[model samples]
Target: MLRTLTRFFVYVQTESNLKRLSLCSAARTGSAMTEPKLYRPPAEVRGMTSLDKDAFTQTITVPALRVPTGVLNKIVKSLKKSTIQRPGVPRVVQETEESSDSRLLLLDPNRVATPSSFSEAEAEALRSFGVAEELHRYELKLTYDNLKSEEVLEAVLPPGQDVTSAFSRVGHIAHMNLRDHQLPYKNLIGQVIMDKNPGVTCVVNKLNIIDSTYRNFKMEVLAGEENMVAKVKENGVTYEFDFSRVYWNPRLSTEHQRVVQLVKRGDTVFDVFAGVGPFAVPAARSGASVLANDLNPESHRWLQHNCKLNKVEGKVRTFNLDGRAFIQGPLKQELPGLLRGKASVHVVMNLPALALDFLDAFRGLLHQEPPCDHNLPTVHCYGFSKDDNPDTDVVKRASRSLGLPLEDRCSVHFVRNVAPNKDMLCVRFTLPKEVLFCSDEEHAEEPASKRQKCEDTTDSA
Candidate 1:
């Protein structure tokens, strides 16, 4: 019985495509044809380039009942011999219980049967095969005019099964229109809200069109109050971040703590890429005067706000200007007190990616008579490692240009891995007195006689 069922199913699958076409054509031409109320093609049909014909053959061949060993062998042999040899044709034969025990015999090709005549012939074949049981069967007819457009699918399940539950188990099934647009965004927003990290925040649908144009775009998270607020407790201080108007990372404050530990008391620090006072506030709290600047108007505004929030507005002076332009500007010469002989000025190049490019300007900033006091403008440089080296090579180049001995004067304090196998390093160096005064040609050409006379005078004293 199982062998007979397998043979019947193989015949159905091998001929299904031809059968569908004939059925469709018959329905279209007949007066009794009624449009299917709920039937659609599977979504896979659109993107499907090819399929395994043997898979369908194997799928239909599951045995319905045991058969004699000899009969099974004979049926399997017959199926292998009569198997369709088309490129995508099946290699095995099978049948469902409705058509079990059926055998297919080729008829004379000279006679072509009509649609009704073919149906009658199929019914007769089922009867001759001893498949006498009356069983419920459903023919799922799916069609689509344009493959790219939406598709609908229908399935007939066994009795007592919940249709919705069965469909849900088949996870790949989706509604064409609903899945295309609605589901993806819903999943994204769900992920954002479910994220465990408190530091991570997402702004959703802040930009909305009103009237004739779009304007007044802002940031809004999915959770929290009407205003965005996050409170982080670190280093015995609870810092509140207002992310409504801007976005700020608390990790920067942690980095600032590291920077402060590197600086000694009474140090004047310059924070280049100062975003919302993360570095400046912490440095100022460490008793270092901070000169913080950023190019973004909104960022500078928030930097000022954060300074006031932390009550370090007095120690930190905020500037709204381009860092490189300000460094190269005439302020160095115009304000000798602020620039020249000011050794307490520690230049912080926090932006590691682009900091190496500004080495020349930074070096120029360090150039002054007696060079800003060793206590005033100390240059703290930052750079990241690449694949070629463990330490950033740019720092070596910057040190050489400043006339500082790479090993003796410079100190590499922190090397933190920002990415896999790549590190962010902070290096501090003090400019030599000679290099700062080297621009004075008269000083450079000082005679040995004058130098010896000064030495003799120092010995006499």
Candidate 2:
């Protein structure tokens, strides 16, 4: 049966299906109405053949079953229902003297007549219809397996150059960080990404992080629609935010879950540099009351929106304030109540850029209080380190920020690597009574030169 099916392909290959094809002006520009040639069909088929690159216009030879000419219309109908029938490719019929009672029914090749491609149900259907092993013999071409993202991109992009494969998908938008040389083909690359991936409707390129204060970056629409609002679901909670306005790193999802896992029911969380509440909302959903604050007003707005969206508004108090102010104001106000309780208290500072500098804000944060033995907020402060010993370097910076040694007081955890040399580190430490309650007057003043040097090294987020 398979051999007969294979032979049919060769028989159909010699015949023309130009009547089924949409004849272009160039194909029909002749005094005589000559049949149009197949759009770049294979000159010869020996073994398996790959489809033409121009899949839309390319034509392929489909095997036709030899049956009574009277039932040809019914056979066509059944084939159309079972396979992809291209209307542009015309059908052909042939008769031989020995097979005078039988006629060949040529159907659309692209539809479903390939020998190597058929479902079990299709095989059963063919057998039920008495499609025996005695039909014309020809080899059927198999369909090529789908290409990888990089492979598809390489074919579409310029040869010999490496295509950028790094992209962050925020909801339906694929965000790519293309370099300077790749800028000219940004639109083409974006379109290719959207095409190769499913469920992605938009593509954008990060131009630069222009407004550092808000963490809002400049982005150009490379492909798809010009919509910036993204709806992302992480840790089983949905977050809606403007991708162009707020800073939302889908990459930090693991980190968000890690921190939230530490927070249990009845615990209180203070998110100082919460951007769009990736940390705050999940922690709140985990049964912790959260006090989330961000320096960006847009982030503050979306944080509140997301809190309500998740129905965790009652558990979360949103604030738009600088990291220092958030520590000195709402956090300071809530610290007393948090300490008097039995529940755990977590302070999350995720802004790795300048969060180390904001550590000084924790010094003299709470005023006129004696050392409490009951509850001290465990600070989870993140910072980027580009040193030989990242752990030690992060601890040293945390110590300098707190105005106290953290070698014994803190535990440093490696978060992730941001770049070749830069590493993101999280220093988890119990807020020291000395630093948290130290009087402003007694706080040690650093030398002008020393403070300048500290500021220079800790400015990046």
Candidate 3:
């Protein structure tokens, strides 16, 4: 029993020495006791003496002085002007029954040249306050854990290279376009962004535009789960779409709202090339009757789904047809009846890629001899242009397609800049009366040059 008790005491002393040496190791490295140990484990019974030489350069805590509560505030204020108070660490207070008279003052002994010998001025000040030679020792906590994503990336990214500050957020996915230099650190940058931003569960980088026919782009998952179904809220309406299958641009929110605001209750809207009814559903909700059409089966399905989702199915008539067929069929039949009631009719052609050429479909559309009124359908044609004067460019293309001068009759609105030199423009004009009432002779007399030009535009788009 005596031998067991002696062995236990020795073990306890060995454990205590091990803890002391461990703490001293941490202090030398300027690291906190609670910080993660990234280095390999020290050899058994040898403490942290086997740590790499690089570990010694790591930040560690310095010993501090505990001053009386009465002098704590004054000493802290004076220490701020002097070199005694450590940089970056806040002055901490130890709460106790004597809290009002005592507090802790952390100091960086590493800043002094002769760390073993105290400064004359510092020792004199401490001696005046009855301070002892013993100092409070503990690991210093760093503010590194609270850094922002950009700050964390700055430390890891190579010098002279900039990080992308802008990223598109679709539901839980963050879409970024990183340069070639940034690809190497893409995973680390993505993880840091996910950690700093709440509600983002995934990060994806756009590789390139792969499917031009369907407006689909190829993207690779940089971090997190690979769920592409995104729920986006635009212009007060919620839209759920398979981001991988359908085309949804959050940048068009302003344009969608602008056109929807123009239509009053009881107005009739015809949306050609409408992908998922970003305009149609909103117009229907505003009490306007909408005829929404899309060629893509998936987009058509989602458009119908959204109409039901927004509870506007009753007001919207959906169709899956080519833009020209939709214009020459449903719109042709619906216009006369709608015009008889003297209701405002709007034709929305939003496929900027080919909508300008589709304007030729309006030629010889209606054969009605005399519509007792002059309420012609107002067509909103969207197109893309790379000209310096995009407004004039769109108007000229629109006029050439219709074979009529639209300079005086039309109004052009600049939609947006798709790229540095390319822009999207909306040309608003009334469908020409002659084309609406296409007599056989006048239809035959259509300019051959104008018809060929329209065909050329379609082929290019």
* lDDT (C-alpha, whole model) for all candidates: 0.42, 0.68, 0.68
Query: How would you encode candidate 1's per-residue C-alpha lDDT over 1-461 as one tens digit per residue?
Result: 55345444643443242201111112233322233212223323322323211212211111122223334444334323222222222323333455454423321111212223234544454345444323212232122321111111111112232211100000111101112222323323222222322333332333221110110124333332343444544454344544434334333445666767776666677777675666677778778877787766666887787778778889887887766665655334433465534335567776555454455553434345454443445667776554344343655756554544456567775444433334556777765554444454423221211101111100000
State the lDDT at 243 in candidate 2: 86
TM-score rank, highest first?
2, 3, 1
- Work out the TM-score per prediction: 0.45, 0.68, 0.67
Tens digits of per-residue lDDT, candidate 3, 60-119, equal 555666788776666665555333342344666474565676767765554322323455
Ten residues in sequence with the least summed lDDT for candidate 1: 166-175
lDDT tens per residue, model 2, 287-321: 99999999888899999999999999999999998
User: Model 2, poorest ten-residue lDDT window?
Assistant: 14-23
Clashes of each: 25, 11, 8
Quote model 1's TM-score. 0.45
